[model samples]
Target chain A: MELDPKRYAGKRLLRREIPLSTTALREALQHQYFKQIPTLRKEKNILYCNRCNATQPHLQNINCQNCGSTHLYCRNCIQMGRVSYCEFFYEWAGPNPDWHIHNNPCAWEGELTKHQQIAADAIDQTMKQNGKLLVHAVCGAGKTEMLFQGIATSLQQGKRICLATPRADVVRELLPRFQQAFPTVTVQALYGGSPDKTGDGQLILATTHQLLRFYHAFDVLIIDEIDAFPFHADPMLHVASEKAKKQTCASIFLTATPRQKEKRQIAAKTLPHVFVPVRFHGQPLPVPASKLCFGLHKQLRKGTLPKGLLRWLHNRRNPTRQVLVFLPTVVLADRLQEEAIEVLLPFTQKILPKRETETLIRTVHAADKDREAKVQAFRNRETAIILTTTILERGVTFPSVDVAILDAAHDVFDEAALVQIAGRAGRSPADPTGEVVFFHEGRSDAMDKAVRAIQVMNRRAKRL
Target chain B: MNLCVGCGEAYTSRPSWSTFFWPERISLLCKDCEGSFHRLKDSGCPSCMKQIGSSICSDCLKWEKTSYQGVLEKNVSLYSYEPFMQDYIARWKYRGDYVLGKVFEVEFQKLYYQHFQDTKYEVVPIPLSAERMAERGFNQAGELAAFTRAKRKDVLGRKHGEKQSKRSRLHRLTAENPFQLLSEPPQYAVLIDDIYTTGTTLRHAAQVLQENGTDFVAAFTLIRG
Candidate 1:
C-alpha cells in the first residue's frame, strides 16, 4: 500500500541520520513510518558502511596468520572507517539533492582553446544526450579549464554534480579552485577527515573513495585523473564509482595518458573520446634524449657516480637551473644520495669552498616525513638538486627544471610515466626549453615510445 | 558477497544479513574458521563449569576444602578454551584490538539473557587496575558486558599487582586477593570476566563482594580453560 512515491521525492537523507539509534529506528518503523504494509521484511544482520555502502564482499577479513580471531577486521577502505559485519547502517530513505535553477553559477573567466572547446562541446553533448565521454588530453593541456563549461551548463540546468578523482591530493588541490569558480553554488568537498558532512550541496567534490558513500546521488559525474593510481588499480573503487551515480547519469573520465585497454575501447568506438594533443603553451612537449651511462649499480658499490652522470650534473646543476634525478626506487634514491654526497663532497668543496653544499643537495620519496616541506623548499630554489623517485612523476610541477632518469629501461618506467616525467620540464613559459636526459644501460621500447609520442605531439601541433 | 572477517575471503552462497533465529546479527567469521571454536558443554563441574570427567572437578573440590568453600556459587562459562580460542584471546587481550570483542558479543549476550531473564541479578564486570586500563585503553570484560541486556554495575576495583599470566600455578592459587569493593554491594550480583584461568581471581573478587554485603554471587566468563 505505497500510494505516494512522490511524497519522498527531493528529500535526501543518509541512512544514519534518520533516528537516534537502531532500536529507535526499529520502533519508529514498527509503529509510525508505514501505514499500509502490515508485515516487516526480515532485518539484515550484516553491516553496510553508512559512509561507503561496502557490503560483505567488499570487506576483507583480517585475522592473525595463526588461529587468532581477535585481530579480525575489514581490509577494504580501512584507511577510512572500518565497516564490519557487526557494524550497522541504516537505509537512505530520504529526499534527493535539492535542485534549483541558478544563472551562470560558474565565475571562472578563462577561455578554452579551440581544441579544448571541441572537447568541451563533446562533453556537453555527453551530458545532454547521455553517454560516457573520455577526455584524453596530454599533460598541461588545460584540462581543468575544459571541464568548467560543461559543469557550468549542468549547474545552470539545476543538476546535482559530483567531480571525483582517485587521490585526496587532487581533491585538495581542486577544492579551492572549484569553490572559487562556483561562488553561488553550495559545493562540498568530501574526503576522509573532511569536516563537511552535510550533504545539502548542489555540487560535490570528492575523492573516488568517498564516492562509495553515495547511491544514485549525482546527475553528472566527472572523474578527473580517472587513470591514476589506486583508482585504476583497485576494482573496489571501480565498483564504487559505478554505484555512486544515477543510471542515466553522464560519466566523464579525464586522463592525460590513456592505457592500452582504454585506447582499445576508444578505438573500438565503445568509449567515445576526445583528444587534446597540444599543451596550453602551444609548444611541443620536450622529447627526452637518452645517454647511455651503464653500471649505475656498480658505481654505487664503488662509491662513485658514472663519469657521464657526474659530468652531466656538473654542467647541468646551478643556482638558477634546478635538476631532478629520478631513481627507480626510494631505497636506491636514498643510497645514491648518500654515495653521491660522499663522492661529490670534495668536488663541491673544491668548486665552492665558502657555501654549505649539503643545502644544495636533498632527497625526497614517498615515505619522507618532510616530503611537502622539502618539495616546497626545492620549488623555492633553496635546493638545487632534488634526487627523487617516481612519486614526483605526475601532479607535481617544477618550473624550468632539468630531468634525468638513472634506469630509464627499468620495467617500472612505463611509456605513460616516462611521458609525464618528461612533461615536467619546460613547463614554465618564462623558460620554454629545458633538458630531459635519460641515462640507461640499454634502450627500451618505453623510451622509444616516449620520444616518439613527444615528436608526434610536436608534429600534430605544427599541423595546427 | 559475504567475506570472512578472520581471513578476508569472499563467500557467495548466502546473503550477509540473513540471520537464523535471533537479532544476533550475522556471523563475522567464515564456516571453516567458525568450526574451530565450540560452545562450552554443561557436563562437568557444577561450580566452575570445567569439563572434567567427574561430577566435581579437582579444582572445585579443592575450593570446597579451603576456607573459601561457600565464598562463591557455581560459575557459568560460554565457550571452551580450545587452542584457537587461546590464540584469539591472546591477540584480543594483549594486542588490544577492541573490534575482536564483536565476535563473541551476540552469543555471550544471548546466553547471559537466557540464564538470568527473570532474576534481578546485577551484572558487575571485574574492574582492571588503573594502570592496565590505561595501557589497554579499554577493559575486555566491560566491552563484552556492553552487549548484555542487564545493566552493568562497576562495583569491584583491583589494586596493582603482577599480571596473572606471568605468575606460576602455585603463586596464582595462593595469590593475595587484589580486589576491593568500590561501593555498597548488591544482594544477588553476577561477576563478568574474559576468562576463567584457575577461578582464583573470580573467587577473590567474590570473597571481597561477599565481605562487603548481602548474598549469593555467581560468575559468567567468555571462556574457561
Candidate 2:
C-alpha cells in the first residue's frame, strides 16, 4: 500500500501509528518525503528521547529481548509509545501543507465588550508581529469570543492554527464553539481517545499532550487554561508545545489565574499582557468570606455537621439556588456526603421525601465514573448540592449557585484554586451576586490572598 | 523523590515507626495506583487459583484427561486479572515499558518468599519464541523471575507460532505442545509466567519438564484470568 504524502507532510509519529508497511515507509524515505530520526540519542553517558524531548533521568535501560542486548527506553513518554534505542521516529521533510485561506471565515454574530475588544485587538497585533501575548481575564469573561477576530485574521493569512488547553474537558467544550464561530475552517479536536489523529485540520483544538505528535506544524498557537494541572506540573508538556510551533509562530496564553512565574514576567514587562477584571456579564468576581468553624474536623469525624455550616445551609439567603461544596480531597468529600446525609436527614425528611432527599445530595471527584452525568444532573437542578474536590474548581459554570469551600486551610486549596472556585458563583447576569463562603478551622495565607485578589479585581472593575 | 511508574506522579516517602526497625520498602507506585490492583484471595481453586470455588477448577480437571495430565501440580498467582491489571499488563508486556515490571518487585518477592521459602525448587521462566522475543524486546516472564532471588534456569525453548492470546480456549487446549526441553531437567521445578489464562501453556511446559525427569512441577504467575 502507498502512503499518503499529505498525511505525513508535517507529522512526527511512531511507525505503528501509521497504517503503512515498513517497505512503503522506506520508499517514502527514499523519495525524500520523510526522514528517520533516532528515537534515543546518547550524550556522554546520558540518553535523550528525540520524540518526547525527555532527558537522561527519564530514561531506563533493560535487557532487550529483541536483539538480546542492553538498550535504553524513555519512561517519560512510554504512555504514548515506547521509544527505545533501536527504534526510530519518522519525521516529514517534504513540502509544507498548503492551508486554504478563507476570505470571511468567522460566522459569529455577537460582539465583544469594550475590554474584550481591546484584548482582541492586542492579540491580533501580536500575531501579526510573531510575538507573545497573555490574556489574563477573569472566569466567564468571554475569553473565547475575543479569540475569534484574531483567529479569523490569522486564517485569512493562510496560517495553520492550533488552540491547546491543559484539560481534555476544556478542549471538548471549546471545539464545537470554535467550529461554529468559523464554519468554513476545518476544526479538529484531539485528546487521548479522540477519533481525529490526522493532523490535516486547518485549526486544531487539542490537549497539550497531543502536541507531542506535531513537528513545527502550527503557524499560530494559542494555549488556554495555561495554569491547569498536568500541563503546569509536567515539564515535558512545555517542551511539546514549544516543539509543535513554527520557529516564527505567534504564541498566546489565555488564563484566568496566572502562576507566580508568569506574574513576575508580566510585572517585569518581559511579557506583554492584557487584563480583563470584569466578567462578560459586567459583574465583579465574588469575594469569598471566611467563617471560623471551631473543631470542624472533629465534628466531621463524629459524623455530625458543624453548627455554623448546618445553620448556614438551613438559612440560605436563596433557598432555590443550588450549592457546591468543595472539599480538599476525594476521601473527605465522600465522607462528608455520608455524614451530611445522617446529620441532615431529619431536617430534609420534614421538607421532602426520602428518595428526593437522597437524590438532592451527591459527591463527585476526578476518578468518579459518573462525574459528567452527576454534573449534568446538578445543572438540571435534579441535585441541589454537589460535594466535590478541586476538579470542579474551574472550566465549569453553574449559574445561580452559591459556593462553599470546606477545610479552606488545606494545602490543596491554593490561592489560584480558591479564586477559581469563588469565580464559579454568580456567572449568569440574572443572578450576579451569588454568595461564596470559606469554611475553615483557621484562616490560611492562601485564603487571605485569594480574598484580597478578588477584592482588587472588583475595585478595578468599579473603575472600568 | 520517587515517581510512580503507573501515574508518573512524584512522591516523597514518609518514614514510619516500622521503617525505623525494619528495612524500608520503596514504593514504585502511588497509593491510588497501588490500590487499584486487587490481590487474589485464598478462597480460589486450590490448583489454578482461579476464583471458582475452593476445589480444583473444571479447567484443571479437563486437563487431567490429556496426555500432559498430572504433570503440572498447581499454579499460584498474585493478582486477579481485573481491568486495571489488564491495562497494566498491556503496557508492561505489549507496549514494552519494561520498567513497569519493577513496580511489582517488592510484592512479588514477598509473595515468593512466603510461598516457597521451605522448599528448594529451581525457578524456570517460560520462554518466548525467537520471533516474538525480537518483536516485544523483553520476556515478561524472565523479568518476573528476576524478582525472586532463587536460582533461575533457562532450559526451555519454544517454536514460533500464533500467540496464545489470539486463540480461543478450545483451540488452545487442542493445539500441540510448543515446549522443547533444551537441557537436563532439575529434580524440582517451578515455572514462572506473567499470566495463567487457560493453563494450557503451563501444562505443556510442565509436561516437557516431567517427561525429562523432573519429579515435581508447579507454576507461579503474576495474574490469573
Kindly list the per-residue Cα lDDT of model 2 for residues A296-356, writing each as its tens digit.
9887666456788777777777766778888888777766777776765554433333446
Q: How far out, in Å, is residue B71 in model 2?
A: 4.7
- Weakest ten-residue segment in model 1 chain A by summed lDDT: A34-43
Task: Give the C-alpha lDDT of model 2.
Answer: 0.85
**Candidate 1 on A1-464: residue-level lDDT in tens?**
22122222322233333334657556644644422221112228765444444554453343331222432344455444433333333334433435877898889997777888999899988988758999988877878788888888998888888998876556666778888998988888888667875555778888888776566677899988776777887777887788778778999999877888898999899998998888777777878888887686676555456777677766764425677888877767766777777655544443334566767678898778787688877877766677888878876666768888888888889888898889888877677677798888888999999899878878877797
Instruction: Give the DockQ (2 decimals) of all models.
Output: 0.04, 0.67
Tens digits of per-residue lDDT, candidate 1, B1-225, equal 666655566654444444655434777777876788888887878778888874878888888899788887878899999878887787667755555677887889889987777567988888889878644546888876776868778888899999988888799988899998888888888889999988889889999989888498889899997
Angstrom error at residue A441, model 2: 0.6
Query: Which residue pairs in candidate 1 have backbone atoms (N, alpha carbon, C) closer than 3 angstroms, thus clashing?
Result: A10-A96, A11-A94, A11-A95, A11-A96, A12-A95, A61-B5, A61-B8
Error of model 2, residue A35, in angstroms: 0.9
Choose the strongest candidate by DockQ: 2
**Tens-digit lDDT string for candidate 2 (B153-191):** 998999999989999999998999899989988888989
The fraction of reference A/B contacts recovered in model 2 reads 0.88
